[model samples]
Target: MHSPDSLYQQLQKIGTSPALTVYGEDRIELSGKVLANHIAKIANFLVDEVELEPGSRVVLDLPLHWKTFAWALAALVAGGNVVVGREKIADAEPGTVVVTSRPHGIELDSGDTVVALPLGSLALSWAGELDPGVYDGAADVMSFPDSLLFSGLGDESNASFYANAVPHVPQGRIGLVSPSVIEAISVGYSTLSSGNSLVIVGATSTADSIFATEHAESFTPPVRI
Candidate 1:
């Protein structure tokens, strides 16, 4: 496994390449690679500095941004747990992983004193100093020959592309599939955030399908690439 510092090195490498525009009416372009770095740094802080134990659950209550992505990566790298929740934060879990999104520019509902790691906290120091080039980016890890990580790229035919299309799952891997796109995206972020070194697994159990069907949840269906 790569050292924690390696994560930062990877971030410096990617700088800021867009990830999610963050879900909103007026979306701001964010960087995925930057998010990865920020997330890794937090993980380093929690593990090396705070000394959080493996599998320790830390609840997140922040808005969607590159920083959240960083936190997820940090949690995963730290080998801790994360939980996700909606706008209203709830009672945090003790042992397992927990993560969630809370409003930014304002206080959160949890009444919890959770602060984002690294850049989030660092930004506080430079709140005014920033040039307004002030968005956090997701960590950019491509399946670089040197780097083991890879994001399924936009085009497989591009030789320089780090990733190919999200490949078709072999029948054997279908058991790990998620029933819907939301689940897959959530699962994807979970993997990136958790840094558990486990692949972003897609859980599509019978119970899961039932829940999706009952709730009318739909996964991101395969579309023409």
Candidate 2:
């Protein structure tokens, strides 16, 4: 019954049920506890390994996938500014932290940190050799603890990281599709705030079948026209 106002609060509202489900080449479902563990591990990796400073820019140069959402939440929870967009990705500063599925496409500069996530649902590590400096996101987070603690927390001033104008999502499992990563995150924020589980249909999957199987109500972004 708690209405979460911030990303951290929304994350804490996750219950024992399945929180996120992705229908793709392999159907992936993550319960509330498992999703929290993923976020904690990623947050620990960002803070402990990458040494992400408060208010630092963490660019998510990935598509609208479950892991992408997880990384975004983790960055915010770790006191970093979550940046999403190709323009932001291209103009990332030297010390910015980048998470992407296509690691090779990104050009790294001095002080920049990049973590590559595997496309395979079951992958524990990057299948091939990663560039010398890049971190394999799937492989590195496993060793971290499921809970996290931090000090001297900074305020989230960036408006991009918070939901804007998203409709209230009903409390239940719902299928969501959005035009952009930001919009997806907005809907996701609303979903989590309302204590609803989200089911994202992958490009390769049929929405009808996935929603039917998940018993999720289809939630399409309202047309502006």
Candidate 3:
């Protein structure tokens, strides 16, 4: 009632279902339990914590950092539209609350409300607040092996459909982590559930490359963790 945190749980309860991965056609099949965690995290942070009202446009103005991904997710969690342009694009005008950073400092002019959101720091704070239990694959129920396939849509304009198709992530779960080992979690589950043997190879930023390795490794039973 008073804040977004107040409504966090309520939002998560709404998004639990089978999700389609944006990476490709069948990257990872998720269930309700997994989707609930993501939405809950985002809702708690954006609605309850940041306290942004509905209809506010959050500019995801960070560089190619993991936090930007989280912020984008958080903005959606709070029911806010996102502006991914530079701070100058937002601040050149007036009466705008632009979420910028120290790196690309937006030269503030009169009447410009530049909100410097420390995305990196905020990510740490958010992660610290979460329970350690979550680090152990809060959503993964099993891994995959033989008969596994990997599919993705990617970051192209068409990728927006990924979110639309996959169950909405909880607001609180919309976040970023660099030191956060997502691939390990992903690989572990992929092999175990798919009944495919897996090999832990390095991951490249290229989605196709990463997916290729994951798919190639999923030909047998899982390699030991």
TM-score list, all predictions:
0.40, 0.83, 0.37
How many residue pairs clash in all the candidates, one count each? 33, 0, 43
Against the true structure, candidate 3 has what lDDT? Answer: 0.34
Write one digit per residue (lDDT tens) for candidate 3, span 1-225.
112222222323334443212222223433333433443454344444444455554554555333344344344445554556673364443433345454243554454343444443223322222222221111121121211121110111122322233232222111111211222223222222222222232232564455464343222112221
Query: What lDDT is obtained when candidate 1 is compared to the true structure?
Result: 0.36
For 129-219, candidate 1 gives per-residue lDDT tens digits of 2222222221211111222232221111111110112333221111123323223334333322223111122233453453343332223
Order by TM-score, highest first: 2, 1, 3
Runs in model 1 lying further than 4 Å from the true structure: 1-16, 23-26, 63-65, 86-187, 190-225
Cα error, residue 22 of model 1, in Å, equals 2.2
Q: Compare candidates 1 and 2 on lDDT and give the better one.
A: 2
Q: Per-model C-alpha lDDT, please?
A: 0.36, 0.73, 0.34
Find the number of clashing residue pairs for candidate 3. Answer: 43
Give residue 132's error in model 3 in angstroms: 32
Q: Which stretches of candidate 3 lie over 4 Å from their true place?
A: 1-42, 87-97, 103-209, 216-225
